[model samples]
Target chain A: MTPLPRWADVVLLPLLNVVLAFLVGGLIVLAVGQNPLQAVGIMLYGAFGYGSGFGYTLYYTTDFIFAGLAVSLAYHAGLFNIGPEGQAYVGGLGVILLGLALNGAHWAIVFPLMIICGGAFGALWAFVPGYLQAKRGSHVVITTILFNFIATSMMGFLISRVLKPVGVNSDESAPLEAITRVPQLRTFIELFKNSPVNLTFFLAIIALFFIYWLIWRTKFGYAVRALGQNPVAANYAGISNQKMIMIVMAMSGVLAAMVAVNNVGGVQGRLILNFVNGAGFVGIAVAFMGRGHPVGVGLSALLFGILYQGGQELAFQMPGITREMIVTIQALVILFTGAMGDMLRAPLARLLARSSSPTGAK
Target chain B: MESYLVDITLILDSTVRLAVPLILACLAGLYSERAGIVDIGLEGKLLAGAFAAASMSAVTGSAWLGLLAGIGAALMFSGIHGLASINFKGNQTISGVALNFLAAGLTTFLGQSWFKRGGYTPQLSGDQRFNPITLPFAEQLREVPILGQIYFELISGHNIITYFAFIAVPVTAWVLFRTRFGLRLRAVGENPKAIDTAGISVTRLRYQALIITAVLVGIGGAYLSIAQSAGFNNNMSAGRGYIALAALIFAKWRPGPALLVCLMFGFLDAVQFRIQGQVFPIIGEVPVQAIQALPYILTVILLAGFIGRAVAPKASGIPYTKER
Candidate 1:
């Protein structure tokens, strides 16, 4: 059986998976007593339907976009960058440490530089496991997960002792200077009053286009495709498997770090220990649902953004639904999306079978 | 010397309790992985079991029933992993990760909704919870100089599961070594294609191994809720299942070695707990983070392919296809 056109897979496959996931996963949501339509409606409304919610939703979707690209970058080069949460946290650590050191620098260059540093820091942190996976052939999953625990604990230590935000008991670093804040119309941005939805979202869109271009248009993309399609083949074709592995992981880590940068510079203006909040991990789902493509991952991320928003509305309005339900949906998307390739193969093959075949091949 | 003597015994006793969960889980992993299934969802099953045990024990007021319920829940959850990965050929790691999230969410949701306890389940009474059943009060023998304290602390004051856990370790060894089924399961893991050609049903073996893994993990989960804490909290397994995975590797995937690895891990954990105040006091009262991290660090250092080679089963995570 032949595969779908690579072009159509990029455009339509993720949407189809998501549509199917929602329909199928609806049974699960209904079993839990949530009205799936209303729940989805509430989610959509909460994210983009009304008030400042749309801004807030897009704002976080940017982070999702960042994480999605991060996961996809690794996916391209045949690496599973599972330590995004850890990388993001470590990036946040870098952000606050740098922000503090440069306490009152102008937002233009200083902020952008810090953001780059955030990405660089995340890249470096992920490089540890990436290098290990390439060199020592350690299981990336175990190493990344182990790193998450260490990251959490290390962050806990840093927040409580070294970066303790004065007068606040919560585990967090002190707030960044107003000068360091990402430019945003926090005041009088009609409907969304206090949201930190700023230029970061635009940055995320720019990143998406850049990633899409990188994956499809460049020679590097060919190398990544070569590596991911079959590492052995890629190596046989004169590509450096070790180099690509490390580079792709670093790229994934950079994407993950962008999540931290957005969270600190725009939203929280400080590192919240809870900031990781599984967003980095959820990127795995986004990457799969998006089919390791930038645009698909972006839209899929928006779908989750809607879920997050709607789940909140449902929880608030009905008290029966829980935010955890949204989490379940997120996890379910990954579960179903991972099987997405298999799900399509037989059906697509059957549908597009040759005319000589009786009643279309099954 | 006296303090050292007491601390060592305490650590050993705690080691046994902690070891039960890890041992049972590693055994669970053995069954699945030995059949080339790579049950990464052991952690999820453990969490589901913990939740089921905690909730059921509270409702039924029977620790035994709760244990059974926990096992049933784990089996169901693990079955989902099996069905998705084995039948549908989904990515095992993603499925396992999803199960982990699902377990965390569903447990937390139910725990909060029904129990009104946020992320924790309702607390049970002494009888409802598993407690240490001290050995038949030996009046004179427990008074021996050094051995007495060791015997009392190490062997006595453990719930019934602890003793059963140790027993199961050897039983697992026997099953894997002495039994025909063990050989088949191991053969399937190492070379399922050969096993398939040999006329052994790889499907049946994998299914059976997964079910067995679920039940064992169920016991560990029950131990977590009913025996260890008597209350269910969100993510209470707290990566112990992964530690078991690490132990499985540290033990070279052998039952006896796995058991020793579990005990060593438990001892490390106990030492971490015991050294809460004295060791590097800057990290505050709960020194568990550094201590908890020790196993993972050791795993990386050990399996950085430095000490030895660890090769997974040839077709560990891949779904088998008749055509292929």
Candidate 2:
């Protein structure tokens, strides 16, 4: 078997896996007595058929980009930062606190403040587990998983007990002043008319370039990649694995924290419980499907964005294909792209080898 | 003093009840990890088990059938994990995570489709659910003070699943320490090459470990839905599987210590339940969230300093290949 070309490995493989996952999803739909083609049609229409639908898809895409980048950044450092849910949750608190404190401040001032504070909060939340992994010998995966629950309970407490307005629902904070809210995309762009997509989408694109530069261009990036590839060899080359782990994890947390900024400041305009939802977990799959590269992450994030919006449409159009069923489909995608990724790799490699070989010369 | 005694009993009772599921999950992880397989998918298996148990009980009106069905479903998931990690030589963590998503998605989808109550099964009634069992002479023992209170409150009046959970701990400890299979399991975790040299199939050992783990996790999930509550709710495991992971770590991968650690976590949960809304003048009403976060906080603290370096099985999480 021959090795796949870089393009095939990067672009074509994930696309094929996605197709396979969709086929299996179609089978599931059939088992449930629904036409797979009709469902797909509805989903496509729901995700991209209209302007507002496209805007909403892009809005979710913004979230997945932030989260996928977070996971990808950590993956480069040979770490699985599963605590993004916690980090994003804590980051929401930071954004909310800043928004509340600077309630009457200009949008320009508040936005930057939110980014700094939110990033710091998220980084700080992750830093403890990172420090433990680096110095205390605790596995990052275990600590991060535990932190997710802690973060949830902490957010629940804060939203209900401290930030909640009296005589109102205990699960959400009082709305921030309109001055702090980012204008919706529809306000500035005719294409995204009447949708929640906002300026954060532009920020996500900027982040993509920034991460690409950080990971591929710099000496520190080289050191991180080296350590991830071979820690013993990297250590022999005088790289401090401890320092790199800490910095990379903190960076990962910062990216994850941005999701809160997008959701709370841009979309919700208020802090709500579980606003991060399962975006953090979904990010793991995004990074996996994307192959932990900036461009790959961006493309996969868009794919997932479409899936989210389209899944909702499919659920609405077909009662049998419930929202949870969409989750099942998403899970199948993750399974094929992640856990069972190698299922088609060997066969495809052989096929490519056979096609490219000089048969007549041989 | 009398009220304090009653409170202690109440807390102990809740602690025992809560610890049952946690103990089962910890033991499940213990077996798998000991066999050199990292089972982060315990949460998934537990949830699948809970759903199966609840749905089957709701339909068949037999808790035992629900228990068997739960075990079967959990085993199916565990088999997938084994096939992926063992046969495909895939990343164990990724496989585990995928299993979790699959369980979460599948259970809800099936439950919603079948029962139509937003992914919750129909609530089981008396004969279909595991009810608390009163001990022999419990009514007569009420007047016997401390021993009677211990017997009636702490020891007795829990479902049969609780008894199985407690018994399983000792059995697990014995199996891990006393038997030849136990030695092989320990050897497999520490150094699979050594076992391979001894002409044993590492894959089979790992698969057996996973099967045992799944059955235990299944029972844990069944205990949650059928004994703790009458029906299964979506994502009903609610991170207890992770708490069990913390317990496994806190116990330093030993069975006896794992059980004790699970109980300790349960006690923390019971305390959190009792003190959720209480106000204190000096501290200004400890928020329920702080109490809920206590076990995780303590686990982190223990992982960092309190416990001296908890070492996992040496080969755990590394896919063992015959050639490599």
Candidate 3:
């Protein structure tokens, strides 16, 4: 296949999206009278260059990976899966309960079991919308949005009412015992003279590889992709469209659960309100930004994690810029990359189609 | 028995107040989606309008002027949404979600930075408040047994906006069915290609409809801020926008049904508020969370085939494209 033309194969689309986002982001900075170059530099350094900052970035990215994966799985089955936020919380509850309720079992056995429980619970939550979409033809967007509020409020109810921290008046769960805990890597960064990245970072990469194999190297993958492209055609091709959608949604649920299990169990180790903090929504941005590719999703998640960490740091250092600026930047990035990018995608797709047609046919 | 009667009256009055904003916002949503645009940003637009109205009213000492400012700002925001989604033919849902996120961040930032408040704008006094109109025979009516409280409380004594919200229902019905512009608007929504062939501009009609919805939603937001609480706070609109969308779906996008749907949801919310201390006295302190979650849970149930399956406008949430 005489090496696919570089521009048509790669360079243009993702590059164009990044450039467009930056330019729009730059205009926003200018509007606020901040030097675009310096702000960008500061954001980068604040996220990665500092000792503590990069640690938080890695920690944050771990959650993002789950979110990105969740969105991508749903996207593969032609479902938006907007309920990741809800699924993540349910997963968070599952892991937290497991951690608290279980005694001092062996680490290997207990940890894996909790993770599976978290994923299964999360997946079950996601399946409701998927089932509705496939069977009743309900719009996934409205259904999922509805579930998010229910999940958040229900979790809050349990945490504050039934699962309140022992010997405390406040609305919080008791922190997990050390035997059931994820060992802190923050100290290991100094002790081992290594980066602040945790064991979860390695686990995330492994998960991504597994996702890639599941998506590309499996028969299920073919069914999902086919369903996404055209469910009617996929049905004609002897694939069960409804089954494929349910499976994909289940996969998304597990991915969303990983965020909750890993974040709550491996990092925070307690149930908290708003703790998911729009990561699910950001995952939608990442899924579209990455064009539903694993590697692309990983990179976008890292970039977002960096920005998030930096945004927190900037709030502390500047005193002038508020913590909400981070959210503004996030919104603007999503706007340019998601909606505005579509405005440009059609033209680029046309150009690629034209250039690659006859030559590519050969 | 008298106490029970007072409780019923209070609950009735609360339902009307609760339903007015939902009715208005749902009507706004009906117009936009009917014209082939999805509006997930109603919550955000309402937030921006609420904040603007509250701040403007507090500063200028004129509630009416604040309402005008709120409408103007919302129209401009909706115009941005239309330009991005309709003209540029971008993804409508993404644009709407982005607008919400932007509003969430921007308003909070400004509220804390400028106002030096706890993400809340200052409260306004009676001078900037709207008065409700009570029934004329209320003195004689409350003593008139069965229909007494209903006539005095539920049927009457609602603010001007509540009356307007109910009237707007028929006006929307008439505009949608009788008027030439409304027919063309529906045509653009249902089948833009047909409208394009019939010498109508799809882009223009959509933008016009969105802007009109924006104005109505702006009034709804003003009612939320000044009329609901007589002030504003960051994120005060909460999830009212989503609830309205739920009502719109539950209503199946028609005004007559939309009004009833809003009232039903409003009733649910009002009952939840009233019962937190009675039925769930043990969970009495949980009112804030319970009430907050009520609308969303109802929405999910409705979507899951409780009330009915709601089919949206056929061409909704799709960006219209034309050949160059």
DockQ of each: 0.56, 0.65, 0.56
C-alpha local distance difference test of each model? 0.80, 0.88, 0.79
Stretches of candidate 3 off by over 4 Å are A1-11, A29-38, A191-197, A345-362, B126-158, B277-294
Docking level of model 1: medium
Write out fnat for all predictions, comma-separated. Answer: 0.45, 0.59, 0.58
Give a tens-digit lDDT track for model 2, residues A202-309: 989999999899889999889989988999999999999998888888888899999999988888888999999898888888888888889988998998888788
Model 2 Cα lDDT, one tens digit per residue, B36-141:
9898898999999999999999999999999998999899999989988888888788888888888888888888778889889998889789999998998789
The pairs that clash in candidate 1 are A42-A310, A43-A310, A52-A191, A52-A192
Each model's backbone clash number: 4, 0, 0
> Candidate 1 residues B221-286, lDDT tens each?
999999988789889998888888888877777889888889999998888777766745575465
Worst 10 residues of 1 chain B by lDDT: B279-288
Better of 2 and 3 by TM-score: 2
Location of the lowest summed lDDT over 10 successive residues in candidate 2 chain A:
A353-362
Alpha carbon lDDT of residue B256, candidate 2? 94
Tens-place lDDT digits, model 1, residues A109-133: 6678777889888998888788888
| TM-score ranking from best candidate downward | 2, 1, 3
